[model samples]
Target: MTSAVTGRRRLMGAGLGAVAAALAGCSGRSGPVPRLRLATGPQGGPYNAFGRALARAVAESGGRLEVVPVATAASVDNLRRLDEGSVDLALSMADAAEDAALGREPFARRAPVTALARVYVNYTHLLVPAAGPARSVADLAGRPLAAGAAGSGVQVLAGRLLGAAGLTGGPAPADERQLGLAESAAALRAGTVDAVFWSGGVPTPALTDLARELPLRFLPLDGYAGALRERYGPVYTAVTLPAGAYGLTGPVGTIGVGNYLLAREDVAVSPAGELLRVLFDRRRDLLREVTAGVRLEPRFAISTGAVPLHPGAAAYYRSVYG
Candidate 1:
């Protein structure tokens, strides 16, 4: 594994160990700490880092719970893991979660999961070589493009963006690449691909690193938000990346979709409530580290779109907001 993945695994293992030690001395009153498995995204993506922070927070909260972070393909794969009972919680894009709840294309039947909270907004990044010929989504037609990995939420958003731009398969249909964030960045740097569609938070780690090594620009997609939402539901929204967010000169307008933290319906109410309490109580600790965690506010936390909130999550919101 890469150093980053190893680091995340070590962080989670340490958290679990701490929880186990704490629970062992608890006089057997509450029994062993409740172990909850969280399905996170690929190593280089934001979800993995954020999940590790959450696991650490829960471990330190003195609550009767232990969170284990499991790295997996994002969204589609995470939801599948939740359905299979392999994971207790997952992070997913609002659209994908809605599809799973409604028994849509990628899902064969409704999934038994409930939303814990709405997390950050993932911006659709149409990244291109600064000196390359492509100036807009239209310019990328027939050119090489990386639309994220096959099972990732980025791939779904990429298809929607390309379709909105009237580029069904674009030019050189075979040139469309389905690569992960790390692979996509390397492909762009090596001149293997002309452009890439990455739907992620502003200043994505790989993109930020790539920008330092090469000149890059984000194409505006604010115009397509309407059409995208009209077809895909209200899950799509307009979001802006301010100037200097990723060392860019000016603000870039883009389309974004909310990310939801979900849990299986069977997870107990008390542990779920404790998880949310620790999440917000230690929010600043997370914000100081992960930029994506900055969006985890209590107000936006309740906006989970069509997915219903878990009973424990609902109680947490009520106790705080009331």
Candidate 2:
């Protein structure tokens, strides 16, 4: 078999061993392995890939857990699913999670979501044609722009950025188009869209692919960070995108929001603890599959602002540190 096939077989072997152990662990008081549904994002997206990797790790850790990765519209949708009790675990943007907790727009009322960990940072990316007319987000006014999908976290952030530029309603002369990441990239390349606003981890594979096809520019969002922070909350932070990241000419400045791994408040503590343990224990395997998984550091994981930590997550942290 090929190396790729060999690796998968090895992983499966580990997972089976873990399942056997899990059965043994459940022989006494706790009945059986916990089955959980994890809501991830669209296919080929960071959240989706992250969720799959996590599921694999949980299966390989000899833990009594069954993690099901469900593909959805990302942050906003994930939160909704968790709230409606369709899923037990989810990955969401800090801003959306905060909004859900506060019963803000897009959410009808408060949600019972609690944080498991702050996993990574999603940087705001304002991609424009290298030879296009727009120099900044403001310049895109009156131009064709592709925001994220309508109900997506991208749309939420895109609206906020547009508002920051003082281009609300008819003030901004732009045709706002809402599209998914891949579609947005395609539209930009086809000259159908002037700009695309994407919030994701650095070196996003899709953007990297688009850059190779056409010259592109990274417009900075640093200027509006303060305004966004003041208006939104502590979730927005100014961050520097290093030079050569995505083959950019120099370091670019942008706003970043923490990405959180969340669970419903009612989730069983033991299962949640086991899931967290499996994540850290099989870090090497997960990292091999996703670069974003590197952000799953223990110290950083506990800093989920505004969102309360799940009891099981707290127990796991205590077990590791104390």
Candidate 3:
């Protein structure tokens, strides 16, 4: 009888031990796990789509990544947020990154940020009404133009291009409106603005939508493309918009800059490395989610000129491409 009792006790003890082990596992005593917060651009833009795709990829990779969509002025503001440690990851333009890193132009001092990867090129789109008198950058001298938003990279580059063409601001200063791309598009369609400058990827949804509803023309920047490239070095490159890319009658020659994924200098190396690996490893899946992801290739990932690479990101690049 004692032997029978001992056998039953042992079975109960074994059951209890198994339950205790399961409870311990549920308690999550496993080491510290890092979570990432990725910052992306305004609604209905390439950055937003890309951010969502990346967040999904990270989640599937067993990493905790939260995507934060910010209604920002785009690259310039993104870089500022990165420097201030307001975000872990951000999308930025090479032009804005170069300027911020070097403490030139809009940035009063050097910013604390580094690039993870150069994802794609953004075209400098000078969209005007189909019947507008301004056919080229030079003709926009005294016209009412919306040069994107105040703190946006688009504004920075638009201002530069305008200044280069001797068209810095409207003849009557009050006539110029520095607004966000979405707002500028709306204002243009309402006939409240004569023209607007948008530096973005091809098939930008907003621009495409506008093209469908209204007759539009993209003013070719060919004349000044060489000069801009020479002045800006690798930060600016000659890009061409294929015919019908934006429903244009013909291909438009323009200057462009690469868009990169950036991060704060202090972000954890491990998580950053994991984030980059997920981005590149699942590039095809991301592209299926958004066409902009097609540009997120290994070849262009480290194409930034002088912008320091995040050590974690650099490590991943060297591992794969080295």
Candidate 4:
């Protein structure tokens, strides 16, 4: 029999055991089994999908470390949880991670967070009805739209996008709704909303499924990426969503944000580094869940912009290049 199966028995144990795992891993080998809580995003999102795969990889590696994936609002929520020490690991967008680390807007205080790696790029998507009058962000004025769930990174970016387009606090600001990916798609199909803003992996599963049922018209952000980059830091970049996605005739230009696997500064070094080892080795497992083009490159993993890499993860990268 294979000994690679995963377990959550530790989570169901006594509070004493929980106290013992205050830090996920030990400095050296041999200690209480490392069990970590990973804060993933909503169910119909890439963070949750990739996070689950990582958990399985950890279990299947037959490693001493165990990870439990906790579902919540994306990026912002994940960072907050990591800050409070509620979860040992988190998945977040680079822009949001930058905000949290710098005590910027949406984050009143600096979060004690560091990156494990830059896992993937989140393609910002703005979808409208195929036959709707809203062809651009400006056209969405006074139109009802879903801007991702509250406390989510999508919402923050949505606000930023709208603000950049001069749509916020104006005479005709967008009628914004806070809904998760699945709910937003359903709203769009049902004609309850005119547009939906989602920042996720390319070929996002929920959006793809929505395209099948309801024809979608993706609006191009055009120059917003450059505009945003000037206001923000290097977190925002121009990226193209190539042709054939959602049956589009040609490519659509959009903003791209790197997604980072994050952890608290005090998280132990051993399990943190071990998690990356299992992650890169089991990269194929994530492909089963994330978008087709989503990849984990060692050099890109260390390119988390302003967010500093966790010492453990930095050591792992050093070991890799050395």
Best by TM-score: 4
Give per-model TM-scores: 0.87, 0.88, 0.84, 0.90
What is the alpha-carbon lDDT for the whole of candidate 1?
0.79
Model 2, TM vs. native = 0.88
lDDT of 1 at 238: 91
Local distance difference test, each candidate: 0.79, 0.81, 0.73, 0.82
Q: What is candidate 3's lDDT per residue for 189-221, written digit by digit as tens?
A: 998888888877777777888888888988888
Q: Clashing residue pairs in candidate 4, if any?
A: none
**Best-matching candidate per lDDT:** 4
Off by over 4 Å in 2: 1-30, 284-288, 292-294
142-210 per-residue lDDT for model 4 (tens digits) = 889999898799999899999999888779999999998889998999999999999987788778888
For model 2, how does the per-residue alpha-carbon lDDT over 1-322 read when each residue is reduced to its tens digit? Answer: 4442353233334443344443333324466678999999998888889999898877776667889999999999999999999999999989999899778888999999988878778888998989977788878877889989765788888888898886666666667898999999999999999999898877787888899988989998999999988987878999987788778879999999888999999997778777877777765556444443245666788776667777666656655564
**Ranking of candidates on lDDT, top first:** 4, 2, 1, 3
Between prediction 2 and prediction 3, the one with superior TM-score is: 2
